[model samples]
Target: MLAALAAGCPGGDQRSISGKVTYDFVPATYSATTGTGTLAFAQASKRPVRNAVVQLRQGSGVIATTNTDEQGNYRLVYIPEDDSGELSVQVLAKTSSPQIQVEDNTDGNAIWAMGAKLSGTDAESESGTTLSLHAGHGWTGSAYDATRRVAAPFAVLDSMYTAAKAFMAVRPVSFPALKVNWSPDNVPQGGDKASGFISTSHFSPAENEIYILGKAGADTDEFDSHVIVHEWGHYFENNLSRSDSPGGPHGRGDVLDPRIAFGEGYGNAIAAILLPESLYVDTVWSGSGGSLTAFGIDAETEPLDTDDPTPGVFSEASVHRLLYDLYDSGTNESSYDKVSVGLGPFYDALAGLQKTTPSMTTIASFITALKEQPGVDSAAVNTLLSRYNIGPITSIWGEGDSRMFPMYFSVGSYPYNGTLTLDGGYEYNTWYQNQYYVFVGNGSRVTASVNSTYDVALTLYQQGDVLGGSDKTTSGTESVSLTTQNNAIYVLVVTGFKETDGGYGISISITSP
Candidate 1:
């Protein structure tokens, strides 16, 4: 679930403190067309700190607090009924959660640390009701001041901006400002994971939103650059490029859909590229502290290479490994190590050719674009692709595969009929899918049907664009008919339910009168 926070109110207190919270950082140079720029790490400037925790205090006692909005503006309201004629309040900023709850809350064991006192104000109750104060770098010290524990948001912002800038550095296309929502209230209540609505952190594609969970003193995400970049990578894929990933619960070893494999694997690979870090870490918050796990692409420890002997065509590990090998400049023993094509070629391919490829968005489509990219060596590309068991990519349509058995059939004339058997089990059907290609004449009405021993689904496509599909009927039998122009190519895809496979017979007939 999304974080929903209301404004803070101190009842019976007739005065209010309102202000803005901001931080200073070096912004990268950007271009919307060429994506070439440099990082101004030597200098820095100030920008509003959004969703920061701001608090109001009365003589070391807590009164009220609220989070800064997207614009970094915040207001704390108080009633001065019982206080003296003048009320003095202290305004402070912390790097941790402003609202930490122990039970029945979304934020679990969250914290607000690395605090700096912003200002102190004295207001005449019921007389001078409003005062303005701004909390930022200069308000505490120099413009480039570094305060430990309180600069978590700085790291988060830096990683996000850096990644976006890197993208622009390659293919300078303008994208909308990303909206990030964070709060200490984004935790599960009473350690019940099921009742929790929001994840620790994730990128929502439909809403174009980023959510960060602030579990005070427990788990926090602002410090994990790899994790932040990984999530941002998802935003890049969905918004800037095209992703047909069927969203679901996936893990490292799961046999994923090809689309999901490509999307997840690309996200992982891009994180490492943006940061150029060998160790990728994810910190999980538990009680008072957190534990982290790290993985790598080229190294033996936590390597992207899979242990599964029969890791199929839809393995995320293979996709990420191939991508990492292609981008890594280090002279590792990997196949593509000699040819460090860098992130620029990959970005160009994704934003240009892969966006509208005729085939499904998979490793094949990406490799097809990569081969077409200028300055890329085809021999090195084949070496890396073949090493990952994805087969040597001979064409974008995947015509000549040395491994995993490539299958495609053509229909040349009307009244053409054929019989094919589909099987999937521990021994017979180890993989998840079976596909065939059909070609037909213009204005031809083509009808195809399937009869199988297990529940099956049928999808018809031209290139990668899905034209028609069927799964509504029962008993594993389905038929579809379509009419298109002369010599149009279509792919017939059939699969069992939940990766289950059994014998099936399919027949196709075409007529053009």
Candidate 2:
């Protein structure tokens, strides 16, 4: 339910004062059991007495009113309504002295301090509205200015709340809290020069705040709403993973693999799904004047080549293009003619996989699986292969390994784990013929144990070489040296044929030392 709005002032006139109504710092004592409350305002002896009229208005229309008691206290009924929209309370002071200005003092400890009370509702509704004040310590004036700035835009704040509520209904996963503030000091500025920031997007489970930049009567830009919503999406993704790692990079073999690309892609996807209208269709590859054929490979320059084995950049534009193609292809929806049409088949396939293999439900999971496989790098190529389940292993082992290309190889004696070394590391098996090789050390020295149980086998082959080797091994090292044939292309394999049940770790180092 929305908050209640005060009644309109009497008289149907052509002109009206439109603004938000805050009881200021006035304190009110109300009973939780009963929906009744009292507002108390202090009176100054030097100031002349006056009759104060307080009325609640929803938009330009008034709803209720009451006069202040002799003690400057007022009692009113609480009517719950859609006052979530912009509303204000107008105060009119009637004084006997013509020249004396009656100080309402409503902005002081009167309304702002006590806050508004809730009546005609349950305990939840009884809690008063709370506006947080965040001013850097030792700067009370700046703090007050910030508070006042946001205070002036209560109407806009209310509207934002309503909009948020609506947005949540469609995207329950995006459970964002509301935050209100006086200015943009808390938000980050563009290109490096900016001041304080206030965000309605909280990374934690707390409510978000909206800030009004102490500037009086200034309206927030429409883009601000979009930015806040996008931030909320980050929060949603964070919570969904239940781990902070999902929002950042992860380590892999002495390298920091960035997860931001995938994370941002998902965020953008969520944004598109939630607020399709908010995005400029023209900016998207699927939109007007854009086509999947132009994705990554510029149609004007590179031209589309379905047979191109190499992958290209998987930028946001490219990813969006793929998604758009899937959506348009009817793969997302069901239809015969549309089968394999656009990117729809791909998206639908991924969604289906997520249901059965929940681990693959997230983009991160898909990336992790791809990274673990051997030799699959380019983002665009990974996405393409992952879509068809023809990943690193499958790409090599399946379908005759059509994509297989030898990269490098090794064959020689080398120190094993900085300890025992081996010599005469040569194999006469058929597996050695025509196979790629990646050598680690020169074939000059031998320091490994002579016992057959401490021997190691090495082999090299292209993607289709998944089947020739025996799955038995123990202790040993294998290395092969190859010249730069076809740009450093060759494949090398090392195996320890030791008669032991325990597992051994092998280190592969490249370069001559």
Candidate 3:
């Protein structure tokens, strides 16, 4: 959908059109509670609508197309195909290059936009025209109206713009196309996505789409800049970096799998790194009309949950705080926050070294490589790691920890038989929940089997890539067969289907041709 505005005509021999675009958004109160939160907003301020599609239109048809730059300015020059048609400029809720669209899920995926036109003789001006258009927040004293609701998509755009610019500043790269699904009907419910039941604001790796909540009187995220950047962070990690996390319900204080810890922590920290403010805030009202600002996290200064029994390498709070401290400039609140190598070094480790590391993606793996990056202050990194009681990550496989040392048992010869115990601790689908063994393949078809006290699962990996896996519903044992690749080293992972109490046995033998 497009809304129209007015523009001034010019007098130039060659026809040319140029202008700027902007949008308004209501800002969220920092660390707001019901007692401090209010519906009143200061909406006079405007921000440049960066990187959106801008079109020069004649009457109802598009005559030329361009993109708004970082300053929200665009210029178009084209020969007149028809002198009688009215001239106009249109800015869409979409961007060029790696396209990103904010769609109305409740409707038929309509793209919102702002357009401005010159009527009568102004349309046929010999010179050029300068146009300016803006998208309003749609707030009419008490509530937002339909016509003024165009700002949501552009607000989402601004956040994406901020995030993209931050990464490009740190490194040179192109982003993949992405679509953000948002609508007034989008709600926090379990149902069809098109029907506006967005469930929550999250990125779907399978669909490569982001779903945002947008129920007017209830939970709406159109103005939640941090939430938008947070989800975009997930998209970046999945596409640019590596994410081995098994998705599940997790919380700030919960001790999670190392993969989950890193994935979630990175997602949260990217927001702090990109946003002007380091505070992560989300606002929402309950369906019953109860005003409840969702949550706020001060990644820079929030105190860790001291009561959590296991808070070392398995905590997300520790992971994100560490990441922000690494890139953030000027750290004085704590002596441990001394390292300030900036986003470049961190980006290098994440996209280059950490991507192909043999270990499962985790905080330990990321920080281990982060310290190894050239010119990094390893002593500062070590000091920061010590603050969380996690220090000297010598290996991607998490060395130095007694529970993790001798990470992979080696089976040098054929007809290998071994029994591994994971009594240290077991949380279903966690990094420590499974045991690993390494062996050189002999180019013959082989069967790898695992027998355990509970339902068992087996998986094989070669150089950080999955080779084979077997997950049978039946309990007790599981096996997978794969032909060997000469002398290539392979890692076999064994785990119980359910929570495990103790010992598990593994057998790898050549299978008959």
Best by lDDT: 3
Question: Can you write out model 3's per-residue Cα lDDT over 1-513, one digit (the tens) per residue?
Answer: 344222212312457778888888777765433424433357446888988888777766677788999888988887666554777777888877457877776676666677777665655666776777888878776566977777778898788878877778878968888878878888888798889887888889888888888777778887888889989888887677777766666676666666677788788888889885787778887546555455667777745454234556777777777788888877365777888877888788888767887667777678778888888887788788777667667777777544344545667766776666554245655555566677777888877877665666777887557788888755657788888888777777776545545544444342323
lDDT of each: 0.56, 0.29, 0.73
* Descending-lDDT candidate ranking: 3, 1, 2
Query: Which lDDT value does model 2 have at 23?
Result: 22
Assess candidate 2 and give its lDDT: 0.29
TM-score per candidate: 0.62, 0.31, 0.85
Residue 432 local lDDT, model 2:
19
| Regions more than 4 Å wrong, model 1 | 1-157, 180-205, 208-224, 253-257, 285-308, 311-313, 331-336, 404-430, 434-441, 444-448, 460-466, 481-489, 498-513
Question: 2 or 3, which is superior by lDDT?
Answer: 3
On residues 5-41, what C-alpha lDDT tens digit does candidate 2 reach at each position? 2222342212222222232222223332342332222
Model 2 residue 228 distance off true place after TM-score fit, in angstroms = 2.8
Of 1 and 2, the candidate ranking higher by lDDT: 1
lDDT of 1 by residue, 1-513 (tens): 011223324425356667665554433333323423322334545556555556565544456666667566777777543443333333222222222111212333222222323333445434443443332322122122233223444456546766776776777667665655544445523343323445557777876766555454344555456667878887777666666555555666666656677777787778878876644555443433332222333222233344333343566767776677787775455444455787789888887667776555677678888888899998887776666667777665565454323544666766666666655542212234455546654666777677665566677777556678878765777777787767666666655553444545554443444
